[model samples]
Target: MMNKSSQESRVETISEQLSLFALNLKLEQIPISVCAQAKLHMLDAIGIGIASSHYDFAKNILHALMSLQESNDQHYQVLGVPNKLSMRDAILVNGTYIHGLDFDDTHAAGVIHASSSAMAALLSVGQRHNINGQDGLVAYLVAIEVASRIASAANGGFHEKGFHPTGLVGIFGATVLVGRIMKLTAGELTNALGISLSMASGVMEFLEGGAWTKRMHPGWAASSAVTACAMAKNGFIGPRNTFEGRYGLFNSHIDSSNLASLEKCTNGLGQIWEMQNISLKPYPACHYNHAFVDAAVTLRQENAFEIDDIKSIKARISEKQVPVVCEPQASKRIPKNSYEAQFSIHFVIATSLIKGKFTLNELENDTIFDPQILALCQKIEYEIDPKSAFPEFYSGEIEIQLKSGKSLIHREQMNRGSSANPLAKHEVLEKFYSNVERVMSHTAAKKFTEDFLNLEHEKSFINIMNQLKVN
Candidate 1:
């Protein structure tokens, strides 16, 4: 446990170190491998953003944002749309699109999707400033690096406190990224960090009815960060001890017993590169349900038993993930929409078992109501895995009992795409191409992918974003 004296001593420097790192970061300072990984992650997020443009929810968000646009004189491009929006509005829409599918990259230890907000903020701010792609890439790295560390220090405590770590911690990264791109002073950057605390918020209530609010969290955080940075640059003042004070973020949001070190926010800032460990998603669903999907798919592949032969199926997951993916059992067993289906372990496992795979198509209305999948879902049940390694790898196991008294079992100790069991660059590229091809023509997607992979050579990112438009 961190003693009071040690905790207090580190509070003042946490924001200071984070701000300094953001302010000083350069493309050359980051390792080549980290830069490559960051690009891949950011590219994946951009692909998802483009594909989300075809969804009703994204169209609704764009319509709402359009009504709020201040002027036509100052405009920025929206990914996969011809219509332009104000810079902040573009970030709001773009961030939502990137995270809209729930398939964006996640920093496992932090339990937050880091790249969605980073990509949105970087593209909007970078375009407005007309910054070179190398500098823009560096800014992108800064955002994820800072945000992942802050959230990781919580040790998944934010989720326990009913807060979504991506929104609660993502604003800080967006703030720093905007500050970095704008060339704000260290003191101004620190003030932006403090100002963003008030803007950071996302509750678990969205889980109740599969509310669309969850999809908007990252965009809202990035939107809030733009406001915070502008306020800070104009001489606004905010509390310096944003994370450690009596009424600060962790103190107010997390229970006393759950508090982790504030030092974790700044430890190894420039040296460790925590963002490098962020994981890409192989499925367009909640990260919590991924391992179980893998397990079910494996079991189905190995055993030729018919779905009718299964007497019962049981799944095991960490206790922490129960609320997010399993319970309320009624909702998990019968998801009302794609959003709910994405978060339902019962639905995911059943779909993987029956179809021998789970993909974006599985979330469609017809698939959600498929008789075979629904039958398998009825036979599936869950139990807590006492030995689970959660908030690290999202471990899971599945066991199926046959009517003939045969049992089949499989376990995924480390979910696919995690740092410990990383996806190869080719696999990440394959996933990106798959997402982009949903909206772009084959030739367009191929060219866009080529340009994005070699982003540092481009002089203007806006041109790159323009290629994503569906028409």
Candidate 2:
């Protein structure tokens, strides 16, 4: 019933506030630690992306897009491939690689992988425009902040709506990041956001048993961001209240009743910096299963439970997590493919106990049907923890019953790599080297490490690309 003027008078609209923040945010205001973390995530995403470059699907998809490009003379590097591609093609391919493995960074409160889309968009656009490292870093941080806050505000509403927050809300953040890098006018940024509403989409049906669609979400979002910017610059106009209006994103895409969630999106803005809260993933699996991976490992190490000694293993997780990570419990216990196993809490717990670790190798096709792991997975059962504070903290509890009539328990309230207990630079470097080295040469890997660690001081993405794993 409210008219545009009345709506404006009602409250500062989401699009208006987000556009202003994206345009005017200063780099100096960012804390030194935040700037450092920004580099870490940017580097981390790139490492994971490079590792995925070897994937058959990654290779094929990039090749398919390359065939469609109008010209190949103007191009950007694809992480591991020798090929250089067009701006949009590079963005889509690189972003898809970063998320291909399901090991990218996650923001718990927003229940979204914040880095993949935003960082990919920034880096891809940075390459195209010759943006400096400092500006690129700022754009990455802004994308994370805006994306994470929006995810946090949505709370778990997107999941309830059967959507993947990364694919759903991720495009807006990427759009804002690209616009920032482009130095778009305030009106342009607003129109870009509005256009993003139509482009935003990612369903969570991949949870049925790890489909390829989830891997494509972030890449698609990055692509949408570039498309949105181009449309805005072409003088296209979009609805102002694309987020909170009658048919806005929140109303149409989510069923959330928490009006305060929207307020939380902009409440602290540059002040609190929600991007800092994003956690670098320790395990190459769903963030929901992270704490349990830790617990299962700890329980196995502490009690030294052998396969024959264990009668049953039980995990208590958030009920809302059941559909995505825990349930179709039977199918999860017997995942058909490597991708599906990563979403299987049963597989995560079983493999963690058996291997004392969960990493890229654990998700390998060879490990998918490991009889020992399957036996252990069969004994694993999950219970919904009513007290779980999910969408804020992804906690876990594990109890392993032994044949000797003894049970040992381990419960974790917070996963490691959260901002409260982030992975140290060395830890992140270790992970980066491990993933990148799989595809990068020893010499290029060493140089890439040094270049990435000192990224903010550099001027051109060309310097970074020079250290890529290209043939």
Candidate 3:
């Protein structure tokens, strides 16, 4: 336990250290491998944004923002849309589109969709400021490093307490990113971070109704951070002890008994790159359900059994994930919409077993109500895994009993696309190709890919945004 004096010092230490770290980061100082991985993560977010643009939610958000538009900033561009928006509106829409499909990259420990806000801020503000590709990439990496550490320090406490860590912690990262690109002084950056404490908020209530709130969390984080930076740059004063203060992020957002060491939030900032640990999604669904989807697919492939031959199916998951994916059993079995289907472990597993794959296609309305998938969903049940490795890797195990008195089991200790069980570089690019093709022709996708992957060499960030815009 820390005494009041030491605690106050520690609080000051956290925000101050983060502000200096963000301002001091250099592209050359970062490892080549980490930079390469960051680009892939950003690429993944961009592709998802473009694909999400074609959806009704994207159109609705764009229309709403357009109605309120006052600024005629021509530099900012929304993904898959031709209209120019103010930097803030573009950041919000771009962030929303990246996270809209719930397919963005997530740091397993932090459980945050980092690149959504990082990329959104970089493209929108980075372009408005005419930040070059190299500097813009560095700023994006800064956001990832800051966001991952802040959220992972909570040790999944935020999610358990019904707060979405992405919106809460991601704002700090975005703040630092914008502040760094804008070249704010250390005090100004600290003030920007302090202002973010008041702005940070996102709840897990969306899970109950499958609302679109979760989709916009990252976008809101990015947009709010930009506001914070603008305010701070103009000499707005904010608390110095924002992280370790008496009424700070962890204290206000989570229970005291559940909090992890605050020191974990800033230790080894540049040396141990948290961005490298971020995992790209193989399925367009809640990451918690991914391992089970894979387990079901593997089990069905290895054993020969008719879908009718299964007597019962069981899933072993981290108890922490139960409320998020397994429970609301009735709703999980028969999801009412794509958002619900994406979060439902029962729907994902059942569909994976019957169809032998779970992909963006599985989230379609017809698949959500598939008679065969629904029939299998009824036989599924869950138990908490005593040895679960959640908050490290989203692990899962599936056990199926056949009417012929045989039981089969498969366990995915590390989900795919994670650091340990990584997808090949080519595999990551393939996912980007598949997603972008949904909104672009093959030729355009090919051209976009060549330029995007070579982002560091580009002199201007506008060149990248121009490729993403559609008239």
Prediction-by-prediction clash tally: 0, 1, 0
The models' CA-based lDDT, in order, is 0.86, 0.84, 0.88
Q: Which regions of candidate 2 fall more than 4 Å away from where they truly are?
A: 1-11, 256-260
Q: Please state every model's RMSD to the true fold in angstroms.
A: 4.0, 3.0, 3.6
Q: In model 3, where do residues sit more than 4 Å from their true spots?
A: 1-12
Query: For each candidate, what TM-score against the reference?
Result: 0.95, 0.95, 0.96
lDDT of 2 by residue, 244-276 (tens): 889888888776564426786787888898878
Candidate structures ordered by lDDT, highest first: 3, 1, 2
lDDT of 3 by residue, 58-79 (tens): 9999999899887556458888
Ranking by TM-score: 3, 1, 2
List clashing residue pairs in candidate 1. none
RMSD of 2: 3.0
> Mind sharing the TM-score for model 3?
0.96
Decide which is better by lDDT, 2 or 3. Answer: 3
The count of backbone overlaps in candidate 2 is 1
Decoy 2 TM-score against native? 0.95
> Which whole-number lDDT from 0 to 100 does residue 238 have in model 2?
89
